[model samples]
Target: MTWLTALRALSAAATSENDLQQVLDLVADTARTLLGFDFCGVLTPDAAGESLVITGWSGLSALYVDRVNTDRPVRLDSGSPSSQAFHSGKPVAFRDITAEPEFTPWGGVAREQGYRAIVCVPLVAGDEILGTLNGYYSPVHTFTGYEIERLTLLANHAAIALTSAHRLDQLRQLNESLREQRDALTRSEQIHERLLGVTLRSGGLDGIAAVLAELIGRPVLIDDSRNVVLAKAGNDGELPDAAWRAAANIAAPQSSAPVPVGSAADPTRRFSVAIAKLSDDVAARIWFPARDTDLDPVAVRAVEHASIVISLELLRIGTAVEVEHRLRGELLADLLGSGAVISEQVLQRAHRLGHDLSRPHVAIVGALSVSGEPAETRLYQRSLSLVGDLVAPYQPRPLAAMHRGNIVTLWPITDESHESGSAAADLVQRAIGAVSRTVDATVAVSAQAADTATSYGEVYRTAKGALDIAVRAGRTNTVVELGDLGVLGLLLQLEDPAQLVAFARRTLGPVLDYDDLHHTDLVQTLRTYFASRHDRNRAAGRLHIHPNTVTQRLRRIEQLCSADLADPAVTLQFSAALTVQDVASLN
Candidate 1:
């Protein structure tokens, strides 16, 4: 074949989608035809580097090519052309093969194969030396320098082709990876949409559990503290051994807390069990199963998010029910008169309903200026919510209603040992403290009643009086006990606002004048002193003034009022004067 024909054949072989062996065969045949060689072959390094395999050959017996020991290194110092060309990264030509010591072992075989002279060229690309290409002649011949150069150029072209094939393999692998990731994302989106639709339509916690189970394609079970099943999905039979063991471990008293189940099986299949405390007497347990897939990370995360939503809904529902029950009890109380009959009915109802109302209780009345029709209703609802949290533990069965635009709650105590009047006073005080912290409002507690009947009337009166005092005194956050008022308490007991104001003027008129003339806080100082029980040190500390200053002021106060400081009767008179002073100050 002519050089033009050989070049055409090489171009076609390079472009063909064929196996490496077939391409190597075409290259060897083209090289022999173009160079006019008797024999030609290609050698490639084996993986272990112990030998070079003859991948393709032309003009040689298949048996002889197979037997060639190309693996062992041929020494260049011994003057073998093939070994010299491979090590030097250049072509080598031998005009006389028999005279070369390095060729002695393989010379006989070559002669038998009808080859006497040989030329070899190294196949190299960049810094990589892949192998050597060899050609043989039928008689002793000398290769021209031009021919050796041409063979080197051919070898370089082959090396470039091999590098291109390697790069293509890498790109194919990367494409496959991206495809897998895209497919995974699509699957995740589908699962999310389906799960969301199911959960939304669920009427309660049970629906939520069903949706989660369906999404995960696994079993789920939910129960309350009584082990009564609230929801179930997937398998209805007994749980698997692993699941059962997990449940048993979490069934312990201390294990009432949430347990992340299935975390042990597959780190990615992270199922969890959670027990939520609804009230002191109520709790719920939920089981979440993870999806079984290679995408365990995604499945586990989705299940965890779903569990959180379920837990929150369950807690909200439980709280709402408690509030509803309390409101119902309060409504029942209001329907009956706020008298003895109502007290007896409440006690009897507690016994019949098996509710433990035998506890210290108090009536708390909360007054807030609610405006905006919608906002006012919401505020009242929130107030009921607060009352439920406060009374649920005591089983007081709070009765609530909107009385004169105020939220009034009558908390009933069935325990005969607890004085209703005292209990009511304490409850009002606490309610004021708690409510004030939450809102910019004043709260008051009515005096505790003897029973439900007396409680209705007394609670309203005390609450109204406390609220009036709170508002008039400019006390933003305060808990006032009507019983602590002494003479003022008696006036409040008689519901006489006019007498209360008159007493204030008689006792505090002179002190008020001293304050006006000196531009000093005598009224404030006097109130603090009285509140501290005449303790000068405590009064000074509260006022952030020197104790001596408080003492001097108290002496001046006694002189101005013409009251004896050493007499207990006079101290009582001054204290009553301060209490009544607040009533006038409020107005």
Candidate 2:
């Protein structure tokens, strides 16, 4: 066949043949038949890109193919002609194989195969050198310019065909991947719809757990912060006690490490805990059996989605509770802030709210020492819950409200005239004990109980003043009465915050400035030191550092501010400034 006729035939076959190997084989056969070469071979790089392998061959002997294939992979070394052409992206020709110095070892093998001259044309696609098309001549022959051009054209065609086949394979893989993603998304959507349906139809956590158990093919258990199981589903005879106990010890929701309680070799009897937090106060865990569960990406994604739905449900419950609490808070505020005119309408409204205005009552105010909005909110909620339990003992049901980050309560005095004085002091002492169990705070109560004749507004103001005194006297988390705050009480009477702030700035400004410039905790250290009654050991323990460190810091403070902490007068001034600073911070 003529070269043009051969080229036309190969182009037609390449258009029809989708098989990459068949196109390569056709290229080799055409090169041998149309170009009058003694032998032709098509070589391509292997998967690892480190070597070339003979993939197609035509007009070559069995011994040649066997010897080459037996060698398996031909490394891309400088001694090999195919590697030279492939790396250089240009044709490499040997006019006489025996005359080429690099062909000393392979020249004898070529002579045995009846080839003395050779040419290697790189099969290139863009910047990548895929392989080479090699032609051999028995008699010594120099490749002319015309022959080289024809051979280059044929190799270019082969490169285009190889690139097309590779792209076709990639397209097929992409289509398969897209199909898999669509199916996964559809499954997730179906799970979401089922969960929503269960939420609407059953309207309970147990029903949601049952639905999730059925969908995920595992037992599902939901628990509150106290580890009391609220709902359960698909519980077989086997109990996951180890996972359950571990989850109870977890203060915060997290993916905990697997807890092993069985014999070390018991592989089938293990569980992993993945938690889904529902709210700041509520959380749930999905205990998956390590042996039976796959824990694939899809399963993990489904668990995450279930956590979101559970959070929404918990938030819904909390919202309803807040609405009730808000009504109670509004009633409590009205009772405390209202005047002494005991109208019949006011008495009836107080009656429905479970408050008795006729009986003598002592007002108690509790303030937390923590900072930040979240911390304050947590303290407020926890304090409210504790107070509710504390006041159950005292009758004339306690009225409570969270006002300005303080839990204010009005406890009824059972014996109005005789026992109101001692009863108020006793109530204050009991409240301090209860508030300490959850968070650190200061508790104070009115010295005298008030009835309809005295009015709730006067009692509330007295209780508020006692609370302010308790905080400023550096007696936080302690119960105090109005008389206990001696000089600080007189100082707190000055309510102008600007005057208070200016006094604090003038007193502690040098120490604060030194702290800011040095990134030191001198302000906190100084406050703690003075609060500990100048006891270096107590302050050192609180700071969690050495006593020497505290002593050194105190000396630095004395030098920076030119104030001696040893002097009682100077210590009194610093304490007063700190009190003012603390009160201003709360505002």
Candidate 3:
């Protein structure tokens, strides 16, 4: 091709092709065709900008190229002709490579390739030197001024074409990036819309989980504030133990963004967690195992969107649950009321709540033990959820509610063998045990089953009373059932606790007031004397006091109460009052 035609072809190829390497190849071929050189090469800077690398070449032996690239690549400071042309932004010529001192480093390469002379022309784009376009001749031929001018002219045009190709490549990459971003935004929107639809349909947590799993192509799960599995999608069995441990390490992400459970590069780091805040004190976490690979940015955003959906779903479910909880509490109050009648309206409400109060059922009450610090309401709600979840399998649909500041479950009896109610209480105790991690808890099961709702009041009272006395009796993290305590059954049955407190205060008022004023253990002394079976010496040893000191305290106690410890009825009165005082003081 003519030089002009060759320039036209180079410009056309540069403008049309977006690939940088292909443009470089075309430039190499065109330079060879016009200059009548045996070999041509297009060189670009290596990554460090320290050397000229042969990015594209024509008619060069692979062994020569390989030796130069791997063993002795020309660096900018190497004082070589190509480096000098690149650094100086001018054309450089060596009339005879074999005699050129600067070509010594590349001597073996040139000899092997059989080149006698070479020219290095800098490819200048505007003010910047891109790299060197080199041509090789097999026989000695000193470049004349005319020949140098032609090479320079061709090199200038080649620079424009290469610059155009580089810019086109950039524009193409930018276009692809924008397309990817647009598609990602579109995908995120679709995922968000689908998750929102699940919420609007009241599809519940399971629905949200399923949608999240499908969008991310990974298994998903939701755990409650307690780290117990609340719902699962794309999986049916237990997750890795590392998941729960990792979950415990990171606080729930405050926003919808998902927090990764493990290190980004760690293969063991398998789960991503997002918190669905229900209240300040309670939240649900949505998790997806990374499995073999981490989620992409779009998938991570999808998880974030899923978290919002989950939070909304949890709120909706929470509101509905709150309403049902109030209704259940009201119904439980009615059923457990002292003289509650089993009306049809009540039965219908019970059925609506999925409870069969007419069946043989017994009341079980789980009470939160009094804490030194006051408990927050959200803690109570979370604890109740845990308790309900634990008993759900046994009760199918348990009639449970927070009534009178206690969780009451009227569990249906599958076997009235009496032991079954106790066995059920054991399971309830385990469930309540989970709550104890946050706050202490106690469970009490009634001794009898109520065949109808009318009888529910009595059965519930038995459980409630035992739970009350159990908590007062310093029972925690355990089950308390009817018939377990001897006098507790009698104490709660005969009188309301208020009545007993009053009776104790009246009988022990003088001695307690005296002991308070003097910082004396008059009550302890009297109780120790009675507990030692009326043996003064043994009582003194038990009280960690001298026997004569105990005698002196007992005489003072008699003087304060104006009653003799020797009288049987007087002893009974003091003993009963002390027992009531002891039980009342246990908590």
Candidate 4:
């Protein structure tokens, strides 16, 4: 082809093609055809601008290309004609590679490739040199001025084509980015509209979860503030415990963005979590596990919309709970008051709250046994949730209320024929133990189950009295009842403090006086001895002493008090006196 026709072909290729590789290939072919060279190649600088890399070539041996690339880069300061032309911004020619001293460094390579002469022209645009276009000749031939001029013009066109290819690449990338952003905006709008429709239709948390699962094409779960699973959908039983724990940890922080869990590169082990805040300091969290973990931007937007709907549902449920708790607290306060009766209105209200008043019910009052520290608001809320969860499996649907610095619960007895108050009290203590485990507090319960309205009021008083006795007796995180107290309960009910003190001094005064005079612990030894049911080995274990030491303390106690060693009445009297002493000291 003529130079004019070659130039025209180069322009058409540059304007029509987008791939840089194809453009470079066309430049190499055109340079070889119009310039009448055996081989032609295009070289571009590497990222560090250190050397020219052979990016495109035509009719060149693989061995020559390997030598030019791997053996050594064509550096700007190297003796290679291409490097020389690129650095100097001009055409460089070696008339005879075998004899020319200027071609000494690359002469051996050209001779091995069967080329006796070579010419290299710099591909220049404005003042910047882009690369070098090289041509090889098999026999020695001097390049004419006309030939050099034509080659230079062709090199200039190659530079323009390369520059156009670079600009086209940048424009293509920018267009892709704009398209992605527009698609994302459209997806976000669709999710917003769907969630808004769900809200307008009063679709609850279950509906919201169903919608989210459908949108993300993954399993969805919503957890309340207490970590109780409120709603779950589309989980095919493939989720593990670790996934749930990871979701909980992510949802603990109130972030608006979806926090990804597990290895992000491995979709089977990855998921996401988001939180939605509710009223009354409650929060609902949405979890998207790795059923279909390749969630796109649209799925993420659906999770956000699901979170909003969950927040609204949680607020609605929390408001209703608050109203119910308030009404239950009012009813409990009236029922426990003096001269209160179980009237028709009270029974109807109890039924509304899912409690049966006609059945035998256990009245339980619980208090934390810490001195001078009332429960914080957060602890109270946690305790309420825990108690509700604990009572859910039991019968008669217990009513729990926080009343006057205590947690009061009314649990019904299902079996009237074989009503066991002890079993009911055990359950109450177990429930309180669970609450204490969650709240970092030692809670004690006083329980009394009865069948009559008058008996409920009396049991309430009895439970209160038992609680006071348990606190003073150094019991914590346990259940206390009137039957367990024995004589101590009767003594606690005694109206006069002076008489109670007199009863204590009369039964155990000698041992107390001996301990006071000699600085011994005879009174404590007697108290522990009776607490362990007079078992010397068990008492020794409690006192962290040898069993023989307990025997010695008991002998000393009997000698000091001059009391009989084997009298049931004396043991009972002395135990009651010790309890009375403890109660007096607590006051």
Candidate 5:
């Protein structure tokens, strides 16, 4: 057949939408016929750098075809004409395969394989060399220029077909791979969603831990700061010494480590430790075997998910604990306000809420005259602590409350009378003194009530009264007793501002004159001074003023009254006079 006829036939076959192998077979057969060669075959490079394999052949036996690897690499840099064509990116025409220097090595193999002459043309696109198209013959023959050109054109067409086939094959493989990856991702998401749902519904950390352990196929344990075991799975044996060491280090700081856990002879002795800090005072560590086969990616993911679940659970439980504690305090307050007698029932309820009921109780209340910011909170806590210390010796334990932003506390009081009330009031004054030393504020103490019910209310009322008096009288650090103030206490508790002001003006006429004229704060100074038992340091703290200022005000008060405050009789008269004025002004 003519070369043009062969080209026309191959083109028509290539456009027939036939499989690649069929197209290759047709081309190989057409080449053998048109080129007058006994043998013609298509050889493609394999992945490995080895000999090219015959993909399609016209005259080759089926045995040779079965033995070839289509993906094998061919040595194209050797001196053979085919190698020359491959490396030089051109076509090579050989008259005799045995005579060519490059073909000498393969000449013997070719003779053994029944081949004589061979022509090779490289299949190239852009700069890349894909493989080679070859034609072989059993008889040695000189190829004409026209025949070589025709063969070269045929090789180019074959190269285009092979390239297209390779591309289509690659696209098919890629599409299959993408489909597999997408399916895997969908399965993973489904598993994650199910696991999340199970964790949310599970009762505690153990449920989540168990689920994670099952999912990851590894042993696990969860622990809190108190060294309490929250959850565990797998072997029940104690953690190896190395693992314990790792856990200890993790507790100190957020970190991870691998430590040997088993026998020295064992190759799989290491455990991976992951630490996460939940809060300032809490942390968790996860330990899993570090052996490659034991802890896979799934195990790693389980550990991660478990950490989140445990952390969230801890936060929820901790918040609940705190809320329950606060609620107990509120309930106690409610009971006190309800006039219920303090009994074992109330004590048990308090104990259950984490309160030490054995402590003697003294109720105290404080009001902030200024904004309640961070600093104020600190001050309030400190004040509560100080009050706790003062009341601690009197009770088995001490507890304080911020009853609606007012500082209130209860002390275990064994004795409730005038003397005990005096002592309680005295301790409160000292607490107020301590608070004043740090911040500018006043505090009040109430007389001890006969029982918890009346005592809590009385202390609350007294503290509120004292706060009101401090604001109006411009006083600080003073303890006020409702009982001691007599009818005046009733007036102070009456919620009448005019009554309070009138009483203050009437009773302290001389002191007010001095205060108004000399711009002295006698009323406040006197109140705090008396509340502190005339202790200059304590009074100054309550007033949040300089000790020297307290001293000056006291001096002015004595001067204006022209009375000797040093005399017990005179002090008593002044106290009674103020009490009367306060009561009378109430009307």
Candidate 6:
């Protein structure tokens, strides 16, 4: 084809062709065919623009092309024909290459390839030189003006096509990058929206965990500061307890950023964790048993968002629990103090808290055997917690409360408690076991009439009185029940201290007055003698006095009371009177 036709074809290529490599290849082939040369090659500037590298070649050996592109590329200031044509923006011609000193370095290449005449033309698009186009002639010949002009025209057409193609490629790449960024943003918003949905639904820790696990495609576990698992998902109902236990003990994180419990690069330990502090004593830890690659940014953000949702959920739950405890506490206080019938609103409230006021319940009261006043509210609160937990798992669950410096339980009657105080005894045993593990040492429980209290106030009062008697008598970590104490139960049930004193005075009144006036050991000797079963030596040993001193005191007691110590009936009367006196003193 002629120069004009070839120029038209190249112009068409500039409009139609978008591939840079295809444009370069077409330029090289058209130059070699139209210029009647042995070989032709197209050179483009490298990214650094310091040198020209061969991008397309026709009728050239691959070995030479490779060397030109790599080992010995054409530098813009290398003084070679291609570099001169590019810098000067003009066509450079080398005739009779065998004798030219400028072509000495490429002389052997020229001879081997049978090229003695060469021409280099810069491919210019407007003011910028995009690259260089070169043609080699085997025969030595001088180029006509028309031929050089035609070659220059071809280089101009090639330059325009190359420029258009380069810009098109750039636009295409920019479009691609923008598309990828849009896709990433959509994915991020979706993740955040899903997590927000969980919070809006008030899905507790388990719900948060399930959604996060599904989003991240791994097992998720949530634990508190106490190492107890609050929720878990996607573990197939099995997890390494030791691993989670250790993970829960992490340092309280100030931020909710995800922390790696184990390196993702390490196969044995692959866990990512984030923490949310629920309170001063509690923290919620989120864990992921992920695979061997670090979590992507999306997954990391999901974990952080989950930690935040967990914090909100815990706050909501904690506030609800506090409100529930306050309401229950008020109800229990009224029940322990009032003898009136329970109102409907009170029953409904109790039902909400899982209490059945209609059932037959007995009051059990327990107190610590230690003597000092229990001034700290925390101590009672802890004791109440311990007591409540001890009886929480029973059927028809009992209601427990802290009342009047003691742990009071309203236990529901069952067949197992057929006997009076049996259920109370069991409750006391459980309380003792539970309190022993707490900061409090132990407790003494009392239930006077476990199945027979006429009113709520009477139930509490009898239990309270018996607990007081038991604790004063050093009965720690045990139960006190009237049915188990035989006749002593009757003496303990005496509600009047003056009546007890009057009965004691009726029997031992004469001797008691004489001992007080004379300041003698007669009453003490009588008690010791009876306790020793009339053994004078044993009674003396007990009082640290001689047998003769015991005999003298006993005879003096008999003279004062006008009673016969040798009579069995008189001895029984003294025993009854002394028992009443002792019970009165403790009461």
- The TM-score values for the models, in the order shown, are 0.45, 0.55, 0.68, 0.60, 0.44, 0.48
Regions of model 5 farther than 4 Å from truth? 1-73, 126-128, 202-205, 213-230, 234-265, 268-353, 357-587
* Of candidates 5 and 2, the better by TM-score: 2
RMSD of 3: 6.9
lDDT of each: 0.62, 0.71, 0.79, 0.73, 0.62, 0.73
Give the TM-score comparing model 2 with the true structure, all chains together.
Answer: 0.55
Model 4, TM vs. native: 0.60
lDDT of 5 at 41: 76
lDDT of 2 by residue, 1-587 (tens): 87678766766665663566777778898888878888999988778877777777888887876666555345787467888998899998998988888777576567778988889999988888889999999999999988988899889877786677656656767888999889889887877777777666746777777777776667766665544465678865444553444433333444422222332434346554555564344455555445544666566556666666666666666576576467668766776667776678777876886778787777777777643112357556655755665665655777766765667777787765434644554554455345445545667776667675666766666667667656655666666666676654544444365787898999999888888998899999988998788899999999999999999999998898799888999998889888778755533
| Per-residue lDDT over 308-327 for candidate 6, one digit per residue giving the tens place of the 0 to 100 score | 77888888876765575567
Report the number of the highest-TM-score candidate. Answer: 3
Worst lDDT window (10 residues) for model 6? 436-445
Where does candidate 1 have its weakest 10-residue lDDT segment? Answer: 369-378
Best-performing candidate as measured by lDDT? 3
Please, what are the lDDT tens digits per residue for candidate 4 over residues 1-587?
78788777777767774577788878888988988898888999988888888888888888988897767678867767887898789899987888777667666667778888788899998898999888888999899998899889989989998888767766777888889988888888888778767767887777787888888787787776446677778864644343354343343455555786664233456556677876435487676765444667788778877777777777777677778778888888777763535788888987877778777766676765335245566566556656777776766688778777677776677664323555655665565545444332333233435566345555555566677667655665676766567865655444455776787798888888888999988788778888888898998899898999888878887787777757898787777788888655432
- Give the per-residue lDDT digits (tens) of candidate 3, residues 1-587: 99989899889888895498888888888888888889999888998998888877888887877778779998989999999999898889999988988899888888889999999999998899999999999999898888778888888999999999989999999999999999989988998899999878878888888888888887888877556676778765434343444445665455767776654344555566777775564467777765657778988888888877877887777788789788988988888763545888888988887787667887788866546343566567766776666655653467778877777888887787679888877776776556645677678887778774337877777777788777765777788866787776656444256777888999999988998899989988988899899999999899888999999999998898888999999999988898777545421
Error of 2 at 187 (Å): 2.0
Give candidate 4's total backbone clashes: 0
Between the candidate structures 2 and 4, which one is better when assessed by TM-score? Answer: 4
After aligning candidate 3 to the native by TM-score, how far in Å is the CA of 206 from where it should be? Answer: 7.2
Question: What is candidate 1's lDDT per residue for 430-513, written digit by digit as tens?
Answer: 543343235544566655543533445554665666667665556544455566455545555544557767787788788888
**Cα deviation in Å at residue 226, candidate 3?**
9.9
Pitting candidate 1 against candidate 6, the one with the higher TM-score is 6
Q: Over all chains combined, what TM-score does candidate 6 have?
A: 0.48
